[model samples]
Target: MEQTQSLVLVITTVETASDAGVLSRALVGLSLAACVQIDGPITSHYRWAGEVQQSSEFRLMIKSSLSAWPELRDQIAKLHPYDEPEIIMTFIDDSSEGYRNWVIDQTT
Candidate 1:
């Protein structure tokens, strides 16, 4: 069957493992995301509030369909602690056929 919606990988960073866990569960439980992989205590260096800041953060790699992007983004924005959080989406042009189908099945 031809796919109407493209798969995407959404990336975001959170302050702690607890926050990561919360986001991962919410997205998957709500069916906005098929899977969420959390990785880190990775170090981040960026400018915030007119100053350079450094911190340890956890990264959430969320898998979902482009069709679900809006709701997923909105939900993350609401639950995220940062006034402006990092929510970036990348289109998945290729993947294992079975895995791709699984993502479609889980999200829809």
Candidate 2:
């Protein structure tokens, strides 16, 4: 079996489902992500600008390799509407080898 490349699941939330769709397509089109899974109107409650706020958001789980993170992050920032968008990355170092390779291959 070939060595597995590091895979990452980048998370970001948008106010509307339409925004999620657009961002997902753009990332995949740019080869920044292999696949983007869009999930739900999740509730988010947090403090921002010294105020506690709540919002209904659509979350995107972007699958990509570690090598693509920097460009992907910048692209997300450029496209996201929120002033302080939540862009988080979680490394899936324990992921199945086949899946990891697939994500890397698709991104490349």
Candidate 3:
């Protein structure tokens, strides 16, 4: 049997909502992602430059096919403005069949 249900949710953050929009558009336009949802003016606190820092940010939740992970990741790096942007990926192994199929179709 062939495997037909593999997807990934890639999460990343940027300093501005405009940055989020730019990244989202690029990913989808390149067919590297099926969907990119931006959420926030959220606050994030983390250590950077050897000091604790807090900033307002927007979060990007990218839906992509498993096979597109490498390219999508590299694209994010190329477009991101931060010195060390946050790029976290999670496997989406279970979802409604219609949704899963739609994502795979769009990305592929």
Candidate 4:
């Protein structure tokens, strides 16, 4: 195995547990992401349609690489239920070497 490149942590929230599961499975099944951690029932307070809204949502921590970002984003956009899904990708500066390598290997 080669040295692992930088990875991305994409954070997103959805309205339902079922939506979370669907998104998670799609990402992993397509090898667009190595894994997706779903942490649920979190309250989300945000602005929508010029009004502050509060909702219960499931959060997904999607793990992928820069190389996979474009496709991953497209896939998420296509499948995400919301008109404007919150798929925010953050670069990981440091991570476990073994796990990072594993993520890269699994995805691409």
Cα lDDT of all candidates, in order? 0.91, 0.90, 0.90, 0.90
Q: Global CA lDDT of candidate 1, please?
A: 0.91
lDDT per residue as tens, model 4, 60-89: 999998788889999999999999999899
**Stretches of model 2 off by over 4 angstroms after superposition:** 1-4
How does model 4 score by TM-score? 0.93
**What's the TM for model 1?**
0.95
Candidates arranged by TM-score, highest first: 1, 3, 4, 2
| Candidate 3: tens digits of C-alpha lDDT, residues 1-105 | 134458899999999889999999999999989999999999999988799999999999999988889989999999899888899999986888898889889
RMSD of 2: 2.1
Error of 1 at 105 (Å): 0.9
Model 3 steric clash total: 0
User: TM-score of each candidate?
Assistant: 0.95, 0.91, 0.94, 0.93
Writing each residue's lDDT as its tens digit, candidate 2 over 1-108 gives: 233478889999999999999999999999999999999999999998899999999999999988889999999999998898899998875778788878888876
Of candidates 3 and 1, the better by TM-score: 1
